[model samples]
Target chain A: MSVKLEFNDETLLCKLNGEIDHHTTLPIRLDIDERIESCRPQTVVLDFSNVTFMDSSGIGLVMGRYKVLNELGGTLEVTGLSDNSYKVMRLAGLDRIANIKKGGSKNGNQ
Target chain B: MVINEFKMTVDSRSVNESFTRATVSAFASQLDPTVEEINDIKTAVSEAVTNCIVHGYKNSVGRIYIGVKIHNDGMVIITIRDRGCGIADIKKAREPLFTTLGGDRAGLGFSVMESFMDKISVRSTINKGTTITLYKKISGRAK
Candidate 1:
């Protein structure tokens, strides 16, 4: 799994690639959490454009990040979800916590 | 008539979860399942294998057995078994958002499996093992 992070003044954009499963979730979680905590951005965007596969573990990843941003008074946005990814996230009720922008990149502009 | 049937065994490790899913999806390809169907199966397989690695073996190396059978009627049956710590309460375990691991687990494994597959059943015995069977009907063949 690969995670690329970009930061502006108030928004942190995370681009995730490869498969996100139980084995990879912890490292990805820690990596993103550390950045979010340090940067303390007003908004965090998770880009899933290159995420080929995700399971329930993806739900935990998003939920964990959501909690982190919420505590920091930061918002979380999800983008670039494939149809399958969107279905899994929706089933886990992640769309309720994070703003889901379909077909967009990390910048939230398609 | 049955189109194909196969069984595989893999180490109960987090790294093997993706392998298990990929194997199942490839095995089910004879049925020409739709992209949605393939995703559903892959997701369900991931959950089962992850359960074996996390909850069953608790990070210890163990063995996970998977069996896949596809029928001419366009139905697939998947069986995942692990000989590790068995679930005491299957009912509570199937409940959505109920996880033994507090963090990084949404407790949606079984829930997602139930939602994706047409039918699912779980059988477990303490100190013995657990077996989860999933059944789904594939619709709309790919040309």
Candidate 2:
């Protein structure tokens, strides 16, 4: 499983690990959406510190989640993004839709 | 000057996305690219491969062809080709946030590829297929 779910207060935290790609996103999307539907939290945070690599698929995952949370009147926060991931997010215009925070760790699990 | 190249064909399935990225990255290892440089190549290749799997062969299974070449001058060239439905409008498709796949897709695959790689070329025929070639230079190579 690439996603680990945790509920803190009214926020749903999804800690993502492994490499995120087109094939792996199906399960991850289902996992996160299931949690969002169950709790309907005020904010859903996608933590990517542990994610080793990401492509445009990661952008799609975040956009899809944002739509889900938006329907529930909840917001989305992206955190723990490595520099490489952070750059991709910015290019996808994610910074405008969600609060994005860079991860403290170096790239590739270092 | 050292030169290396490889070619591969894989099923246009989501499961092969990561594999394609890893394979291309490994071949690029011949240039001894830095972490950042390698990551750039991986991400760019992923976008192209994802396009083949998700967009090119959206409704059916097909074969995806990929070729990579590295020059001692620190340049890497990768070509991803798909024998599936071709894009009608290459310009619009390359636009960021433009996607026909809709749900769960940012339509930024081409943009991401263009961003990570120094240059990108796209060619397609209505019913033929789409072929994309990406170019990037790996800086910081030792003399």
Candidate 3:
């Protein structure tokens, strides 16, 4: 998986691509966490517009990140989830911890 | 009657998780499943295979067996077997967010499988192996 990171309006946005399963989550998590440590954005945003497939590992990724950001007093948000991804996210109870929105590449600006 | 079935074995490696999901989904395409149905099957398959690689094997390499049977009644039955360490407590393992694995594990594999598939059952013998079977019906065409 590939992650494109940017900082806009005090938010660190990560755009993820390709399938996300147990195998591909380590690197993505490490990269995002490292950035969260270095940049220390007020809110860490994950953009899933290009994520083709995801399993429970996606939930783990989000949940783990939520803990990391919360510990650092930062917030988390996710955007651009497809119908199925949103279901998985909600199933894992991520909706309660993170601000998740459904939209395309526009970055939740529908 | 079983219209068709497929089985394959792969190494208990993380890289094979995605491959297994795609292969199973491709074989499932014969049922003419919808995109949502395909995603559901793929997600369930991923969770099963991942359980084998991440938890069952536990840093060791082994063989993971997967079998799929497509019945004439539009039901797809998938069985994933792993010759790794079996689960000590099956009931606890099936609970949501009760994972023993660290480093980005939500302990929701079984929960995901249960939610995505119509039926799921698990059988395990400590130090022997574990097998999880999933059943789902394609609401599209049966034949």
lDDT agreement with native, every candidate: 0.90, 0.88, 0.92
* Candidate 2 residue runs with Cα over 4 Å from true position: A105-110
Put down candidate 2 lDDT per residue, B31-92, tens digits, no spaces: 77889988999999888988888778888999999999877788888999998889999999
Instruction: Considering the two chains of model 1, state its CAPRI-style docking category.
Output: high
lDDT of 2 by residue, A11-82 (tens): 898889899888889899998898899998998888898899998889999989988888899999888898
User: Of the pair 1 and 2, which is ahead by DockQ?
Assistant: 1
Tens-digit lDDT track of model 3 for A1-110: 98989988878999999999999998988899888989889998899988999898999899999999888998888989888899999998899998898776446443
TM-scores of all candidate predictions against the true structure: 0.96, 0.94, 0.97
| lDDT tens digits, residue span A20-108, model 1 | 89988888888899998789999999999889998998899999999888888999999998888898899988888999866778555
Per model, state how many residue pairs clash. 0, 0, 0
**Sort order, lDDT high to low:** 3, 1, 2
Residues B5-111, model 3: lDDT tens digits: 99999999999998999999999999999999999999999999999998889989999999999999999999999989999999999999898977788889999
Model 3 ranges with Cα > 4 A deviation: A105-110
Best by TM-score: 3
User: In angstroms, how far off is B120's CA in candidate 1?
Assistant: 0.9
Residue A17 local lDDT, model 3: 92
Q: How far out, in Å, is residue B106 in model 1?
A: 0.7
